[model samples]
Target chain A: MIDRLTAFVDRLRQVGVPVSTSEVIDASTALSFISWSERSVFRSALAATLIKNGTHRPVFETLFDIYFPQMVGELQQEPDSEQPSSKNDAKPLDDMTSEVLEALLRMDLELLDRLAEEAIARYAGMMPGRPVGGRYYQWKVEQALDMNAITERLTQMLGGSGPGGETAGSVLTALLAREDATARMGELRRRIERIIRGRLISDRGPEAMARALSRPLPEEVEFLQATSEDLAEMKRTIAAMSRRLAARLAYKHHRTKRGRIDFRKTIRRSLETGGTPLEPKYRHRTNRPDLIVMCDVSGSVASFSRFALSLLYALSQHFRKIRSFAFVDAIDEVTHFFEQAEMEEAARRVRTEANVVWLDGHSDYGHAFSQFLQRYGDALSPKTTVLVLGDARSNFRDPLAERLHEIRDRVRKLYFLNPEPHRHWDTGDSIVSKYSPVCDGVFEVRNLRQLAQFIERIG
Target chain B: MFESPDRVTAALKKGGYLSDAEIATSVFVADSIGKPLLIEGPAGVGKTELAKCLAEALPARLIRLQCYEGLDESKALYEWNYRKQLLRIQADENKDWSKTEEDIFSEDYLLGRPLLDAIRSSDPVLLLIDEVDRLDLEAEALMLEVLSDWQVSIPEFGVIRAQRRPWVVLTSNATRELSEALKRRCVFLALEYPSIEREKEILMTKVPDMPEALAERVAEVVRAVRNLELKKSPSIAESIDWARSLIALGRDSLEDGEIAETLGVLLKHSVDIDKARGALTAK
Candidate 1:
């Protein structure tokens, strides 16, 4: 049980939690005092030591409960007292699932947790000695796996396999739940893609990224690091950023006095003061620039789109009227998802709403740009700013500058925010520079600072 | 950072700030009318102080929030004083319990942080969410929730809305990227180390007592040492310390001879000192 507890702490550190050797010591000492006969007492003792920080408390508790569960027989479950060779096992996932299933068969909670971690780690990969955000996500998976183990035990008692025999929706859900290898890889690829794409596009300006990221002290990183990876947290962060960006305005608040005067306000105020200018209030009708943000939500840029759209959505919120959309090979309007509520549901809606009717599902700016002109050209007047966020990696396809030229005429500004580095701008089937001439503005958005500067400048 | 928005841009153009892409973005953002500037960046690049300078330039009060390890609604936004409520309850012990509970959790006892205080203040307030990256995901979510509406929700008290939308500046160290929800709430700026020329200028202006030649040398050594892939990068704090140390020692110039010896005046770790020494010698 203590070994299981130690292993759980190590796992927590991987996900982003700061479980120091001292913390492990505290947990071990606390564990030694607990009466093993009483399961509840033992659990609390471990929790009191391991789960110290306020932000980290919940995840630790969740992980601890999942790892150190209550079962029918604890000692009898593990045969021959020797540990399993987790490192050498090529099929850690298979081994973990099978071992956990066996633990479930025997109804041993502590062993189940160790096996559960092995299962999570099998797909998630071994975390470095230090904790990070990715580990937090895996930790969330661990929490769910704990719950799943309990449910599976209950199901086994009732005579069944994993979550109904259908193996259709539940399979994807279960697969997605257990060691989401694809999503994790996709997330990493998306970050690298954005960082790269951000470098490739036309310059937003110097200090653009810097202003967006600088701070006086550590905040979320500290919290995130302390807590470790919480999948729920990762989801929440992505969702929160997405929601903010989706409805974000170009202008937070505008008081435009550009080559004009407040005739009505000036006249009304003068009249009120008997033509003696008591108070000259400027006529400021806040202008919320309508945006059409289209991203190549392909495999590489999917995660970027997730965040970019969220930020774009956030920017949209500032405008009196704004609309947002996302595209992989095809386009779809997802502006309705700007609200704080229904964010995760919104990410789900991205797939359904994006009409997958492209001839090729690769990067085709020509196809996407042409589609916009044909389907929505009537709405593409000078009043609107057409923003395209992509790597512009058309996979060596015809870099059609014609459609882009047409977009330049129709829209007030054609801005392309790319995530590729500058060196690869003209390489790898990427036709970024070809479309650059038509774009009123172009930028490389690598991090928060770059993204913030991009958003700040537009409206 | 370079005195004002204009100066900062100029420094960028002169190659004072190496990252040219961000300068154009800054000009666009500063020139932008009627937008609550949201500046996020790494620590020591100046997030709260930007607002302070903005406050100095515009002559506004710099309302600030120094976020901590476990900052919450009561600390960051508003919280009712139960202690005051207890005193009131003792004074009015015979009064209705249900009515008292409702009355006590009202605006009368609502305390304010930079967020609410900036909103409630009649004067212009440059609201700074300092070290916002320190806030939890929940806290960031909470701040985003407030930023979206420019109004905060208090179950006990009513929604506290901004009378006049205050100038808001949020700072963060990409310790973790903020939620897009938070990002969309305002304008964005990312700050990194100022270029050697600008840093020297900054040093000259901020610390006039330091010698001009010494300041230039300080900037060069700091910038050079920072470029190395050490365990910990030398920060602005180290630069200032190095300058102060040089002056305190009555040293006329920063020589290679003395530099390798007393690196503790600048770097915190011996490994970093070794790294700096290696970098300096390699140079």
Candidate 2:
């Protein structure tokens, strides 16, 4: 049990959950107090000890299913009232369809489990050592059972309200019945997936299945390779993370205000106390820097730029003075959008309303930098930190390193964030080499984790 | 004080808080192992209510420390009565300075906050630290120190240890990420909105006069509203309040007219109420 538990902890760490040694020990101690046969309580015990963040629960649950599966090899044949009563009488799918429907209507979970097992054994064709994914087996089982027709029939039968009556009470009754049916069918479908996963785990082992099935957390998904779902999830994560950062920043700002004690002031105030320095005064330091963020809203790294802009503006209240600009071929200051709306809405307005495109839509770093200096050059002072976000793909235009150098000399600090990998930095049309030497630091920020780290370091 | 997870569940149920098996197991383990349980969830999902229910179920005296921004050690843990100390020093001015200083710095001038009060109490205590995410870094570190060893260190007086280990429960709405050292000392539970069935059970338990069909309807409508993209979804308390309101108005069924009249009881925001009205009436 200890060996399996340690292996599970190792799997959790591999998938980005930082389970410490002490937490693992806590989980091990929790294991001895609960019954090992009860999976729900056992899972709760492990979850309470291992997981600290709420977003990591889904990943932990997936890894938990792979490690401590529902069943090992095959179903232990236990006959009960719901079984078809003839031990080996092998009935076909067409005949048992009504039994399955009956079980679903009654919402008998144990009966559904048995039916799911029989269905997987007979129709899924999941052989040992097969390299098929779990989704394929689930699809096969879904097709063999004709689940769509079953669901439709179940819905029709379970709709308790009469079709002719359209009163509000009857409508609510129908809605509740439909919801009940959907929940029961969802349970059945989940059981089928878990049973298939169990068989596959016994065949392919937990590690292989874990590697094949584990979905990347939103932070781990690269910004350049994110799908729409990943983008939506990343936006939510950014909103929450920025809120926390803003809280911490507010606390840090107050902590720094009470600076070192001024001995001169303390002694001056203690003149009435006969040379006893009774009250010490602290030197108040107000040193919050100004910020200017320039994002490249071109075709390639548009999502990355939007996410970066959203995160920066969400914590904009903490800065002394902050300004934002969006650019492609031309540059436009977009600090007003964030001031009037939410971050997501502000990002949307930047794409539609902002005049970021001039002749063509390709990114031109030289023209944008010169345009920034021409318009907002006076805005850059010794207290300003300028952040530039883009891929630096200038479309074979001017590789203007001097323009960035001029901006670098005007600001307190200059940082470049490239959404591309470090290897793809100096490739065709990419002028990262021209910009890297001019800035204080050039970082490859390809994912949310890297973006958050860069923001923390600069904030 | 509970014997097992089953007893904890039953006691919570009797105390008007219906919990699932997962929660029961966590509460049991935290009690047996003597660790603080940290509960994180969205607002109005009953995170603070769980701590209150645990205190009632245990029949222990509740000592709450409500956390907010700028909460510090002196306000949360303990503080020195400076005015009293000054008065004592002035009254005994002609005496020896060292003896007067010793008299002023003793336990007479010590003010015990909630954290210290729970630690020094002879009776059983359920220390509820509510909204712990609002605590800044320094107070959080102080809490970590006090929780790990169950003792508070005062510079003037020595360390004050716990007379009895209190059952600590910390609740957060997840507005900020708590420090990992504080989280490492506690067992964690991530609470979400309850299912429709559980909501119905809660309604029936809390408002005993509510009918079964009305309770189910309220639960289903609340679940649907929660699934909508509203700014603020209806919480579990809102659901129970809506049900009780229905019973008060002598209404047995939820129709369009009734919902339009009483929708404000469930949804606080006007935009959410408008959206919920459209969705609920459209069905």
TM-score for each of the candidates:
0.37, 0.79
TM-score of 1: 0.37
The per-model DockQ list reads 0.01, 0.30
Compose the digit string of candidate 2's lDDT tens values, residues A301-419: 86677677766665453344689899999999998887645556788898999999987999999999999899989989987778898999999998678988999998888999889
Model 2 C-alpha lDDT per residue in residues B14-86, reported as the tens digit of each score? 7789999878988887887778999998788998888888899998899999998667777799988766777
Best by DockQ: 2
Task: Write candidate 1's Cα lDDT for A1-459 as tens digits.
Answer: 666766677766655555557546655654454346755445544444443332444455445444553341442233222234544554634455556556655546557545544444344343323233333445545553454554444443323344554433322123322222222333333332222222211122212322222221111332112222322343324333433343343332322334346778787756643465654656445434566777667766665665555555445433445666676556666676653323445666665666744766776677777777777777676667777888888777676789889978977778898876667688867887899888877787654445555654553
Question: TM-score (0 to 1) of chain B, per candidate?
Answer: 0.82, 0.97
Cα lDDT of candidate 2 equals 0.80
Report the number of clashing residue pairs per model. Answer: 84, 0
After superposing candidate 2, which stretches have Cα over 4 Å from the reference? A73-103, A143-185, A227-239, A245-252, A256-299, A302-360, A363-418, A422-445, A451-459
DockQ for model 1 equals 0.01
Question: Model 1, residue A19: what's the lDDT?
Answer: 55
Q: What i-RMS does each candidate reach, in Å?
A: 26.8, 5.4
